[model samples]
Target: MPYVFVGSVIVGPLLGEDAVFGSLTAQLAAFAVGLPLAAITALFPLTRPMSVAAVRALCDVPGESLADGPARSRTARGRTVTWFTLHLGFGGIISGMSLALPPFAGVLIALPFAAALRGSRVGMPEVFGEGWLLALSPVIGFASLVALAGCAAGAGTLLARWAPELLGPTPADRLAAAEQRAADLAVRNRLARELHDSVGHALSAVTLQASAARRVLDKDPEFVREALTAIEETTRRTVGELDAVLGVLREGDQTAPTAPAPTLAADLDGLLKRTRAGGLRVRSAVELGPQGPDALPPMVSREAYRIVQESLSNALRHAGPDATAALRIALDGTDLEILAQNPLPATGAASRRGGGHGLRGITDRARLLGGTAEAGPVDGTWRLRVRLPLKGPHDHDHDPKKPQKPQKPQKPKESA
Candidate 1:
């Protein structure tokens, strides 16, 4: 406020007629006034955050208004102009006028003293016998000063509240910001799903293979060698997939290497082999009757591979040591059906301890490809079934003799 008063004092005299003589001088004076005002007007928007910091420091209050200072919209530039005009133009004028009030009161209080000093030379009669008016001058001046302070505080508080409403972002800007945040959240969720599928499957495979190798290290050296080989291959593949996913997150580096997408027809056999080597008895069959990998889109193929991989990993981790897991893939018309079933163990604690992300990841992948998935225990066997549309919307009749579709394969739903 004092700074504002000082600016008022500095600017008030420059606007007087005596400061300018000719038209040239008048223009120069106008420029002098405009230059500082223009600078303040242009810089206030950029300096709003700094101003917030200053206000916080002065008020000793960590207000919510300060936190929202940085979110001003592109459309609030006009508000900055209005704020500058009010703060500097009217604000300075008001300060100058208020500052004049106290001095005017003092001048009024000094009038009787001047009159008495003059009356002493002319021998004029004393209007007040006890000189009460002279004594009241100090009291009046103190009252004026107190009023000034009260008004200053009130005005400052009002301006503080009013500035943010005008200078901050509009409702549209806030809506845009919310939508941007939602988009960012969706991307992060997709990345998390990818990481969970790829890394989780690899880790599950490593655990199973390591345990099998340790158990058969002396009795079956050949089996142990195969287990070690499987472990190495899984780790390397996981690292490559991790690098590919992380590469997408790198900023300003378009040349980063990315792993190519894996196809269901090519990668499914390798996935089954790894699971078999991990120690569970596995039987797999693929009947791509009409549509092959070329017929399916790349996205669908990759998601299908992940779904099978996750399903196999879950079976290896959950199904008992002697349990036989069966996997079947068949294309019926324009729909691809995938099913995996294994005998449920008497003790279900092992599956619960594995964190239960495999089925959820599979559901997310299938849903992303516009498909359906269902997984649960049915007739004493844990079953996972998914039916994805290869072409657009089309009905494909499933022959129960081939493999009973598990519970009609409900549409994929997001997990909480």
Candidate 2:
């Protein structure tokens, strides 16, 4: 590797007085040449990855990740250039000694045998032509080789220590990377919850609807027609929900208006009717402003709809056949209250039907909207109570009335 730099010959002339000055001058010239070469090479994006690889391999650095990616930011780009300068400058000096010292030591050792081998004093230096000095020449050469070994080892240690400090990603880059991961994970979790809720509710309703239709197949055609119609509507709704979930996966296409979200104003009546058709007797009371459920924040309306939907699905699942549930939705002062109650089943269906992934889904929707939900046995009834603020944490972001300052109306420009 010493000859790899091709600059060690600068030290090849260090023996004579004239060679001493010339060697020092050439060594300085090598360092000078390295400075500009490092700066120029660092401008290319590929240079950072290459430098990281060289440091990891040649410097004996340990770790799978030396640096995250190629340098892009100004600070990282500048660091890449500085590391290149150190490599070219110090590497040239160290490699030169590595090649020159070991060989020079060999020449000195051969000095004692020069006359015997050549039949003359042909290759022997005049200063050590005879006496103990000639014998000690090999000792001096051995000492020089040992010193070179330590110097090279020390240089390598320093490079390994500096590798991460000079080449790893900066704090700002790491922060941005973590934030990106968090946002992507949030989208995935939300989609998973949506898929779970929609599919579960549909299956429960369809099963009951089909069972009811079979019982009345030869009896009342009117009741069978109604049950089949309910099944058709339930499947259609489930397909729309699936499409919306798929659209979000396509690219977070939440604003694509082709499939609107099911809110209380738009979908609650249908939900209750379908659940009743499934054989659960639901006693309902909904009190809303003249503006109806839409008067509240869109998130509040949407989440409320889901909380009730999941509650009914849980009832169909845990309340056994023909189980009756109490449903109530009303605005209580500054908060919106939704309470659902059903008697615990005699059979150990869920150990407690009120608690499961469905219950968790209800609570998650409530908490995400800056609300609270509780479910458990109370007076022999498994009751779920949820309280949500009219203008909650999520409302600020989705509030339709939240005003935005008018743009100066310049030509279209890219936003960060």
Candidate 3:
């Protein structure tokens, strides 16, 4: 609507006498050329930033686009067409009336005054003898134009105020934005969990080893040397894990190493050895059925290793100096069971029921792999047990050519 008014105002002066006194064909031709341009101006989709600037320029108010994308629905397109048509029609009417009426009224008064000067028409001399009214015609026309300009400005302001609501993001765009936010949040949460499990375990081990080394510095030289070596090894491994986690967030780093992660099934013995080196007595038994450790998927192996690592760190942190930990890994059919148990301190059942982030991490890791984990005091011993399902829902079709082998369950053999 405002566009129509502004266009008519600018084009009115250019039309001159033809706007008011031209033939019907001339008026039709003028309108035919102007209307389409008005429609294009109103219906065109501007970029969001440009639209904001235009709205502020037109109505002196801030504006936002209704749709983020260039695509618009049929209903929205229909509404825009209707608005532009009404705006152009109404503005043309107002502008034409203002321009035509003032001049027509001026001529009506001026004609009598002109006739009075010539002393030719009836009653002309009685109304105006001097031509003073003729001089005021130009002033009246100017005032009428000023009044039309003011009206158009007010209407444009109102239109700008309503623009943002009509123009802002559609429902689909909003949904896509929300989904993107959720995905980003999930990534950040997974990174936080990984960092907490990896770095926390390493720090706990280092603290225990360093404290033990310091205590035995004067009493046992050999044990002190072993503790220092374990501390150094733990620090180096922690640094590597930290690099792996951080590399995931780096962008455009083509030189970074792409190495496979170490798994619990393959590195179980090394982990147990490290725990023993930290002055804890650990007895471990690993028994893989017919499929062996290779049967376990990479993701499952990595998570399993983290659970065991955190559990061992917890045992070292909470259990007494004489605590002897037992670890059992057994694969029976399509399930892998990991059980770690340590003798609780003499401080009753309360000491056995220790709670911390390590326990929560173990539970989360197992649950994520479609497995179950239980941790608490079981018959005077602190125990952490996790059972994971090896066969996924689509595992049967994963390698259809491989023939199945009948297997028998074997008891896990204990070793010191």
Candidate 4:
């Protein structure tokens, strides 16, 4: 119905009378004229972008001879040439209507051309497409109407003293765009916070443990044992968390939950297995003492594992292909001391820049979780230490006051 009115607007000008019957006849003629031209223009690739070699070669022919002969005889000379002439003539007529029609009539002619352009671009065939697209040709014509309206409005604004009503609805579009941008910023900030909290914490712990594992691999088997064990436990936890995060990235019907959440109890065994798979040898001695039942909180457990995983991944990236790592986790009352140490590559330039993210990510996680993470060299060895409160000094205190108690750090178990 709306389309019929738009068509009438285009032909209504061609009709001398303003009567309903005359307007209907005008609309019929507009449809009769616009459809065949749109069809011909879309069939021929008239635009520079889509014109291929063969089409270009066809277009090189001289004059209107392609259209002068019968369709049967001309097709052999070139389909593209015939189509090109047809579109050239058709486009000229549309351009003439655009120049001559009132704003409303111009809209009716412009819309269908735009629709045809869109259809051709997407490779949709025009063999039997009728109704809406055919009917909407006048809407394409209407865009010229809008261009004219804009020019008139601008001219009026410049001459506002003569016509004050020309300023139009100027503020609405600007306000909507501002609101949309603000919404986008809010979402980005939240994503940054989540990454800082999770991935960051894991990387830091892994770095520390890997350094420890490398130091004792040959000189002290018992010490190497602890580091290797920690590496495995850490890697497993990291993989699980990574899977969770990636699952969220996938778009589909929600998946059924898979592996259960990382348990609060120390399950560094899973972490150790994964690190081993990545080609890092682990020497670990991890014991969740009698108070071990008091297990690390779920957030701490997952983070602890991530710390291990990222450190080992870094080790693989930085450490020599045959590098070994050590890990040690011990409970001293309410404080959990995690130490991951790896040998400084014989050359000293071992995994310099490569290990930083795991270090930084772990540091961010530790800080957020009411803990402190630190990394770097000590006595020719690379170490990562993350001190997190298991329970706390005050129930809601900002900082806990505990003297850093050094442990009787043991040796790693010799590889069988």
Best by lDDT: 2
lDDT (10s digit) by residue, model 1, range 123-198: 3335432478656655766677777777777666766666666555567657766798898886787778778778
Cand. 4 Cα-lDDT: 0.52
Cα lDDT listed for each candidate: 0.66, 0.76, 0.67, 0.52
Candidate 3 regions off by >4 Å?
A: 1-164, 250-255, 345-354, 393-408, 411-413
* Residue 107 of model 4, lDDT score: 39
Model 3 / residue 103 / CA error / Å: 17
lDDT of 4 by residue, 37-129 (tens): 444553433421233322224334322122221122222224434333443434444544455557445434643555554355544347425
For all predicted structures, in order, the TM-scores are 0.69, 0.69, 0.66, 0.39
Q: Lowest summed lDDT over 10 consecutive residues: which window, candidate 3? A: 120-129
TM-score of 2: 0.69
Per-residue alpha-carbon lDDT of candidate 2 for residues 1-416, written as tens digits (9 for 90 to 100): 32322333443344333443245665565455446755776778888788888877787776444666788788888887887777766777787788778877887787777756323444445677656888898898899998998887887788778778778777766776788889998788777777777778989989988988999899989999999998998999889978866666766454665466688988988898888988789988776655556676778887898889888998888888767899888877778999999878886554464577788878788888778999987776788999998876775645476663332223221111
Model 3 lDDT tens row, 35-58 = 776656655664333444555566
User: What is the RMSD of candidate 3?
Assistant: 7.7
Q: Over 4 Å off in model 1, which ranges? A: 1-16, 20-134, 167-169, 251-253, 261-266, 289-291, 348-355, 391-416
Off by over 4 Å in 2: 1-23, 29-88, 94-158, 164-181, 213-228, 251-258, 348-354, 396-416
Compare candidates 1 and 4 on lDDT and give the better one: 1
